[model samples]
Target: MSMPRSIGSGPAPRHGSIARSSFSASYLSQSPIAQESIARDLAEYSDDEIEQPESDSEESGSEDESDASTVRPNAPQHSMASSYRRPSFVAFGGTRPAITPHGAEGTFLTKKEKKQARDEERSLLRDNHLAPPKHPEPSRRNTLSRIYKKVFSTKTPKTESDLEDPPEALFSAEPSESSTLLSNGPPESKRSRREREDREWEAAVASGKIKTTWQREAKTLMTNASPLVITFVLQYSLTVASIFTVGHLGTLELGAVSLASMTANISGYAIYQGLATSLDTLCAQAYGSGRKHLVGLQFQRMVYFLWALTIPIGIFWLLAEKILELIVPERESARLAGLYLRILLLGAPGYSAFEAGKRFMQAQGLFSSCTYVLLIAAPLNAFMNWLFVWQFKWGFVGAPIAVAITDTLLPILLFLYVRFVDGRQCWNGFTKKAFRNWGPMIRLALPGLLMVEAEFLAFEILTLASSYISTTHLAAQSVLGTVTALTFQIPFPISIAASTRVANLIGATLSGAAKTSAKVAFIVACGVGLFNVALLFFLRSYIPRLFTTDPEVIRLVSTVLPICAAFQLFDALAANCNGLLRGLGYQEFGGWVNLFCYYVVAMPISLGTAFGLGWQLEGLWTGPAIALGLVAAAEGWFLTTANWEKAVEDARERNSNG
Candidate 1:
């Protein structure tokens, strides 16, 4: 191993030359150190260099070795500090290195010692990776890590090596373990991104600023994927079927039902989503903190909380007409929406329950069952809606009632299924104790509720405003909104699947897998979006006549159908992006992104162009096309932008404090 050096004298061989983030090649190209950069960069970022100095571990030294490697012709002495034991992949269940950190056989830790060493490494890795150790393999190592972590939780410095580098001196940094994790090269784009992350880690650790652990990197298995899949299946199956069945009524009625339902759903979803998101924070964080049992209690409490809130929700449903009137008092188109809301209230509790059920499964990482349950509930919801609205000729009023029946019964059925058909470890025991302990549960869900509240208030205002444009425009808005709803359903699976997988991986601290899951979700969502757009385009005109018989309404919607078809792909992107953000505990990002997209960009573009420019309903779509497209792109980028190692680090710091 090479010795430590001062910050600016020259790049050391062991730690390498620090490239200032502010260093421009324009200036650095003229410098003496610039000529020696290859050696510095190689030493700094050697992908094969997994070894740390032996003397640095057991024997203390002022300057571990001679700081005279390549880079410095003068070999000016500069110092750096390198403490916290670097973790190896073996700690995370990858192949164990036959040789130790020093590359010696004699001083190498014994099997127990090796396990202990790896355990500490795993803790650090998992702390950044976001997964818990699974099975008989690393349990012993993890336990020792736990004990060691408890006692020596803080970084301990035995040797002073390349630690005091300037923050910017890492720009020239290169590949990370992730680069090697790929046998073949990743795309240039990905390899560059990975290098940036490694430099970030280097800068953070070198600067003594704690690196953030990635949330999804903790456990990418099935955590996020499960929740999203479950939510998507349930919401999409029921929603699409309802739209189709109602659309068959004719354009006017079709649009009205679709419009009102869309409005109602966003509103209701805002509420449930707000509450459920809090459950995610609570459950994931709690699970991270080793409070697994508390998650069950929180799930139960969320149920009651959602139920208690339902009374007011029901009252609001009762005043659906008044609400609609107040929302769009002058618009005749709003009349149908008002009627629909009054009827839809009967199912508020059911809506709340279904959401709670998801949180329950999500808490325990048993999110796979949600898709199964959705399959059951979605079909039932459609059948009931079809039977009452079309077969029975009840009109838009029947649409709401049928939906209520479906929502109300869904929770009860899901609960039975959870208990009987496919049992869970967390849900296996039903107890009074669980009911009595609601403290943590309430804490977990509160943040999510707050977020939902902010989002709902914003959309509610927009929905109300859209009703005034024109009867035709309103109907158009209805159809387009339903299309948006239907298309959005695709990403829920991707998001939930990510949440469950990422959360478990985070808990287990398996980073590489967590990152891969994020990739899987993004790819899957895009593929689904592509498919949805094709199907929607194919079924456009034929689909609209189901709700209303008005040829004009149908004609208007058909003209716009192609636009929706083009936009559906963006819709998928936005939904999936939001899902990915939620999995990463980045709801705040969603809140801000939505605020900008809906209010600043989307609202202005859609409403302004439609109402002000006389494009009316088409204007609404135009705005969404631009705004939603931007949002989808942003979200997709964010999902792909995740640095799982950082996520693991952040989770560990957060968990340790908690």
Candidate 2:
């Protein structure tokens, strides 16, 4: 499968990124009155002690009378129950006058006399109402219900009085004081509200008020994964439109379009995508650091950088026909494929801009911007392909023209969204500062480029290698690759959801809950894999007909498809395992593992088996299958034995440093 687009899903729980709040600690330290109240309350009651009754019962009337008799008769009578005792002032570093024997003014008090003095003092204090009322502790069920209602409820508070205390206050070390302090704050900003919600969520999880059960995790994963499925599938359809429209022309057109796409992806689009990924970190960090203008700066730097890189990319596409002829055995196919690339070059800059712009919107937490853009662009792209390629009688070359128009349209729509709707604050107009920051961007961009290129190259290699075998094999490889990639759209999104969920849990320091989420993800992956396996296996004979009418190509695809079907489970498992690693903040490890498996293990096995063993197209797939299996096994074992607590610690360290 091609590298999945890292589309932001909008304020989804992020691991290690939640702002750590010191509000409670700061409040206690700054407010001496609050601290004194808390200390006095703690000193007054043991954990096991029940609250004193508000009034004396008939059964305790005799005891109350005896206690009252011990008090000085000349002293004023108070209305408070006689059973209650005032807390000793010494507990919080204060002094109270000692009580003497009732009739002896100068004599020291006995223990019984001291008790009576304390009760009398409590009565006086209650009459003056100095102590706060003690509220009953909420049951677990009530706490969970309240938290869920606050988080998921649709109702907005109509007035200031309707606004409730922040949930984090409920579980604070000193709930009463915490509530008072939190409620007294000024209206929160958007950032502060988000941070408050995050803290509240973490507090709930930590206190076991929100149970991260497998059922809930699965439901959550599906809820998050659904929209992404639509977004990715729509974005991918942009390229697929070209192939689908051109494939119906002839076997030569089919093979040529496939070869052109492969070349364009490897040489141009992948470079744009990979390099653009650096903005994922840069723009987000800039926006997060409260330098809103820096978001625009980073975005400007990336767009300029990508545009600069396009100079060489344009040159490469211009000369690609000659270069392709040197590599591809079929001269006609090579010439046509190169022609496709040359024409596709018109869209190159626009495509790159869109890649950068998508990240630009994502940084501001507008993930749906591109998806909305695609909702229009994708359909328009398909219509243009049909209109230009077949209806306009422009033939094979018309496919690239339609693609170029669609590609150019993408950034325009995204730009409009930012300008009129939202995400406008980040852009403070272009400045020279964007041009000055090359080193950090390039340093970050290279790793992203490598990570993206590694996977794209591994998959595209099969198409390139197929050209050496036969034109028929090349056409079949195209169909196989497309089908596999389409099926991948489902689980890939699930993996993303899984990653976000696991990361959020880990960030909350709920390692055990994170593990439960991981398990649910794995189970979901297996289910998706089985469904795909059944779909592909059952549709193998008919599937190729969608791409080409060539009999040999169709036959070859049908024959080799079972092999692809057999590996679906591995593909799903491997994808989710990588996601789990990303959640654990071990994405670098995943990148290295993918490189090693795809290049070191899968490539040799594929080349050797396809040619040396004469397994042909089936052998080409065998390497990826085995590599995916190994990847799944290796990563799965690591996760099973992994130190989740350490992962949480690592997340904390990253958050602190970032």
Candidate 3:
């Protein structure tokens, strides 16, 4: 073995000039007298003479020598810091030497020992590294960082060498590993290893080894979607509470209430909800373009148009008893349903106003507000229903009355919040500008209304067809419909989210991003639909027991529930694709698609199979499932082939005109 340079004796190597493993502390500590003699002799040399290390041929020869030799003129003195450890050197042209930071002593440490040392050092330096402490104790920022590290930290320990240089310096000053590997002559002529690390990082992102944009979008969507989904679910639960309360009254009461609620949903609520959705396209684009006032104007117009339609709709509800009697010979049930309809009509204007408010709030990205309000109102609705029906003894009349009170309160509360609390900038107190030329607004509103109502009316026709089988069949069908409605709530938010997001992107003229949003929405909706299908299939036999205990009703529900489960994927696809079309100003296309699929295709097949062919209830649902499948296919094709650039142009024009 060659003798190492005597410590504090001969002239030393400069900082980072020599390899870490080149010297031994134990060997130098052996002869203090000899080190002193060499140190006194080396004091004559200048820093420049001892700055650069010799090549490996010279270094290897020095290691082999048994006796001390004359120090090279180019060797630099190591006077930087006694405690500092230099970074490990890269093997530019040959195999890397073993790293030993404390001369030869550093090689003795196991991986665990090295890790423990690093951790201890990190803890000691943590509070002093960033901003200086204000007091003797750790600052809140430092304390929070410690807590965060404890919660989210990985097991790996980082060495001081890794933290010594800033990333920008390392990346900019060095060359890639590939260049060094390929160089057959002098490796130092090419780039350094640090640059290679930067290149690898960029490549990793490009290859998806480390996700960037898509991951960011996924997290953004999840954060925005969770509350919206919860809001839809909680709102739907109010309907469930009403059904549960009224279903216990008796079979006739249950059937009557179910028929009444379904009629209101199909005829009144469905049509109005559809009409109000035109605001989703207009308001979302408006908000995206920073035209906040336009969102309020669109909302006002929707309220105006919807409230006007309700007057004509209220006349239809007045004749609902006769309409019900014509469809089914159950005169007693029809009379009861008409009575329920008349009471519910009191809340129609409130419902219209609330729908408009929700779209307005949703457009401006105030997603959590809707959920917060619904959370309070949903429970209140349930309590009020219990109070009026059971405590006040108003019978079936109480359910609609309770619903009307809450329905009216919902819009009032939303308006108060928007007008005074958070949405003041958008509202501007409802303008008369909303009452201008109604031609364009009417044209946009009609298509969306027709699209949703066509599908809803088709299902109602199936319910009417169920009446042809028997009233018991109708009652059983109602139970099945409730279960399906509950499952439908799962994907409904994805639809709303898709439309709002796409419209915003379109308004911003981000066609690529808008297309990506559509694709992601479809994927998320489909996944949620499939998950619900699995859950429904798992609980199909048992869920009917929650609604009714009658063997016939339970048996009928158990039979049809699986079909409902099968229909969910297609239903989700159809709904989300319709939302995409609405965002693209293609609601008219969706309306025509719905008209053909539901009325022309689904209705005929449903009626013929149930009544003409005598296939009963099973045949009734087969039509809708098949029709939804066709609708999904058609809409998916349209969305995939859509010209997103044109969508942006159309959105701008619509918002400007509105």
Query: For every candidate structure, what is the RMSD over all alpha carbons to the true structure, in angstroms?
Result: 20.8, 21.5, 28.1
Of 2 and 3, the candidate ranking higher by TM-score: 2
For each candidate, give its TM-score against the true structure. 0.57, 0.72, 0.60
Candidate 2 clash figure, as a count:
0
How far in Å is the alpha carbon of 279 misplaced in model 1? 3.5
Candidate numbers sorted by lDDT from highest down: 2, 3, 1
- lDDT by residue for model 3 over 334-399, one digit each (tens)? 998899888888988987787677667755445445556676788998898889889999877888
Model 1, CA-based lDDT: 0.46
**Residue-pair clash count for candidate 3:** 9
Residue 489 displacement in candidate 2 (angstroms)? 0.5
Indicate which candidate wins on lDDT. 2
Query: On a 0 to 1 TM-score scale, where does candidate 2 land against the true structure?
Result: 0.72
* lDDT of all predictions: 0.46, 0.61, 0.55
lDDT of 1 by residue, 1-658 (tens): 0001101111111111110101000111111221132123224433553222223211332111221111111111110011111110001000101011110000111112223322333343223322222322344567788786556443222223324432224332334454443547654453334334434434433444332233333233244244443444354455556666666565455545644654553455445644554454343333322334444545666677778877777676666666666655453445676677777777777767666666555433343455565567667777887788777888667767877787777677767777787534444244454344444445544544554344334434444455575555555555555555445444533543444344433423445544565666666667878888887788888766654466776787787778777876776666556645544545356546755776688777777787789776667667657766888777667666767566655544433322
Write the residue-wise lDDT of candidate 2 on 415-468 in tens digits: 999989988877878776666647767776675565445545667777789888
Better of 1 and 2 by TM-score: 2
